[model samples]
Target: MRIGEVLHMNGGNGDSSYANNSLLQQNVILMTKPITEEAITSLYSSLSNPKSISIADLGCSSGPNTLLAVSNLVKAVDNHRKKLRRRHSPEFQIYLNDLPTNDFNTIFQSLPKHRREIAGDGSGLCFFNGVPGSFYGRLFPTDSLHFVHSSYSLHWLSQVPKGIEENKGNICMAAYYDQFEQDFSTFLKCRSKELVKGGRMVLTMQGRPSQNPTCHLWELLALALNEIVAEGFAEEEKLNSFNVPLYTPSLAEAKLVVEKEGSFSIECLEASQIYWTGYNGSDDYEVNSGYGVARSVRAVAEPMLVSHFGEGIIDELFHKYTEMIVDSISTRPETTQFTNVIVSVIKM
Candidate 1:
């Protein structure tokens, strides 16, 4: 997987708009709510047999968000253990997973603060350094983990959105989709191998309905950045350089992939139209709610805008697109959207 994709907009240390305090709260709330519903509840139930419980977060980026996941998992397991009143506390194993280049330092730094609570159960949280080498291969010892949770991640293909940068046309899209299917299938197959009997996994990723494809979101993003390229705010090379790493995988595509993987029964699969706190649901606004979504494109947009329209034209160009989105939003607030998919599967 490309390091940039793993690092996407949420690398933490404050540069990321979504990592800010207000947004992090919402993300935590959204992420934690579902863990109680499916395989996670079952995972907690297994805490009665202490040795049977193990929880992990897949694609956990460095930030308070990942730590929050760890803490919540531990608390959930503890709750289950208490109800059962078992003598042996479930041994906690936390797999701090992500691309190798992930900011482990930040993740680690945020951990010690929880040492007291994490150590309260006597059997402290075990931190594993496994970085699922590739999405297509097994990362854990067989039957090692009881629960796996991934949030706001995993729509990312194992590599850059292949051929989109080169504008490879139909051939590019077809090749990329083929690779997505193959890689996702391999990922599920490999995950199936490591989960213990009756274990479960939950994945929250961005998605689009097969019926209502939203390819225009990408077009909007591209247009949003065109101003940065036109102005000196961002680089032209960067504009043409990177892609979203994913184009909303359809629910049908997701279901087809899950169906082929064995011993994994789909529990709950849903697609919800969700709002991004940072974006004002307007296209023309460069920065919304001080979240600075436009700043994200600055890395690439700055140089491109300068090259295409000279140094000073960027602001105006960005303004033009921003206004377009704002006007668009006023016209279609309900339809102005982003989609997320939630799927939980249980092992046989």
Candidate 2:
């Protein structure tokens, strides 16, 4: 699969689009927000404050969450500068990057409103641009970026792992864990070259619990796909050829990859669980949990599914997938846990 060419969140703010279905990713950003603030705070304190700061958000798909992260960072810097009694905070050159197919139009259209809300007076201190590319390789010039943030994105390999064709039943791509390790190391090396010395990065993505790397929400989707094949809704051959290019690494695995690359120092590593249907501090079960999961899944996975199975099967496939998720939630609510790994690294 040409992931950069085909993979993207659903475009626009339609009900099924990623703009509407990205609460999970939002929660991920929230989980890593404090770490990001700390990194940015340390960044300014460590160096003579430049007149401008360059920040790039990788895998910043079009959505509220994209600017939400940037806005928070800007606020953090502004607050920190005030506390330090600095004469002025630096202007920001913020880059929002994603696959070329991403819904950059939506991000661009929303920028005016976001700028107005964030900068109030429309000071234009923050310059925002959509950079269309993959983060697995070099996307910026050497020593150009002072800070980088990526959430819920690194899990997606540049392409499907090698030797993925051997798998027939489960499409988790766990068999190619080593492939993921190599790709992740390469990604870090590329970022290291782009970052200035002492620059920092905070990344949050799907991760596996060390005790049980086998557990994942994809298992349920695999089951649903198998059922579709059994019912002849999708061909067995097509199902066998299709595999999601996602890998949830354990914190240890992530650390090992960074260590092997020898460019970034691992400052912090954390593991947390986020429900597919995020808990809003409510005891009452959300009846719409299944639809929520289905929409989120569709936003990211629909392109791959359509390419492999044809667009005709999408609605029916997700309908059955949603039903299965609802039934599982009713019977085994614990299975809804989605592990998130957050890592903060500094370029050495």
Candidate 3:
């Protein structure tokens, strides 16, 4: 996807919920819904019992997802407070953070009026604070946050890996993997300082350690683009400009990096593989529901598709791509697969 398109996809906000909100109800909710609750309950016991608490949701794109995630955190904190036997709930400074280019307009407009409705009375004190630039850099005051949460967001790197743009051999392609490691470590270091001692964090991101992070996902993306290229669709140059920043980390790699970030104990690790079965098994979601996800993968395919296929067969290829998904799901596996890792850690 072009930078402009990516900006449009990431920043814009609307009702992108899948049919019946199945994405939330069937899969994403099962994996990420409770980490916030588990982390908050465990974290509250370790804290010094402060009256005002701070928390943030990193990479919180503009949409209902952000609100739902925030709601998850709020519910967790509220449940924990009850155990504290405190009638006066602490002030919660919750920051909904994401890239500056993100559509704050949509996010701000869509924010819920009653954050506490599901969890009951609590002064959420919600705030819209853009990370402004990048997650690899500082976005808040020192030791300012009590808890940090990010979901299906951190797996994306700051930008596409270098040299992959040039289409060099695997040598250059490896840049994506190297970059993911560097960025993740940098993120930890940056986040470490912002968190108070014992601050807690929950993150859910897509990954596949068994496959080469540098190649597999991009290869799949490339294959998808190839079809578009063969049939002629978008411009090839635009595709070349896009890149995904994240690399799926192996279990060992994830543990090593967090351990290096000073003192952090990995609390929970789970595998969540998912299939993007759009409403009624159709691909029209590219224009609506899948917009954000589609934009995220654009860099992986656009340039190759356009450059290879030119402009004649774009639509034809997309049709083939869509059908393939349905066909694959209907076959034997029953559903397509995506491997995800959910990690919870505490800074000591």
lDDT of 1 by residue, 1-348 (tens): 244434443345554233453353345345546554445657667544656456777777555566666676666666656666766666667776776655667666766676675777554455545463444567888988888787766665676554566541111133456667777788788778898888888877777756554544355556666655565565676655555455467777778788876668988887766553345556544346223433433322344334433666555655565565555555655545557777788888
lDDT (10s digit) by residue, model 2, range 229-309: 999888898788888888889888888888889999988888999888764444545457887888899988887888778
Residue 340 alpha-carbon offset, candidate 2, angstroms? 1.0
TM-score of each: 0.76, 0.95, 0.78
lDDT of 3: 0.60
TM-score of 2: 0.95
Native-vs-model 2 lDDT?
0.84
lDDT of each residue in 168-229, candidate 3, tens digit only: 21211445667777888898888888999889888777666565554333444555555554
Ranking by TM-score: 2, 3, 1
* Position 37, candidate 2: lDDT: 98
Quantify all predictions' global Cα lDDT against the true fold: 0.60, 0.84, 0.60
| Model 2 ranges with Cα > 4 A deviation | 121-124, 279-286
lDDT of 3 at 338: 67
CA error at residue 313 for candidate 1, angstroms: 12
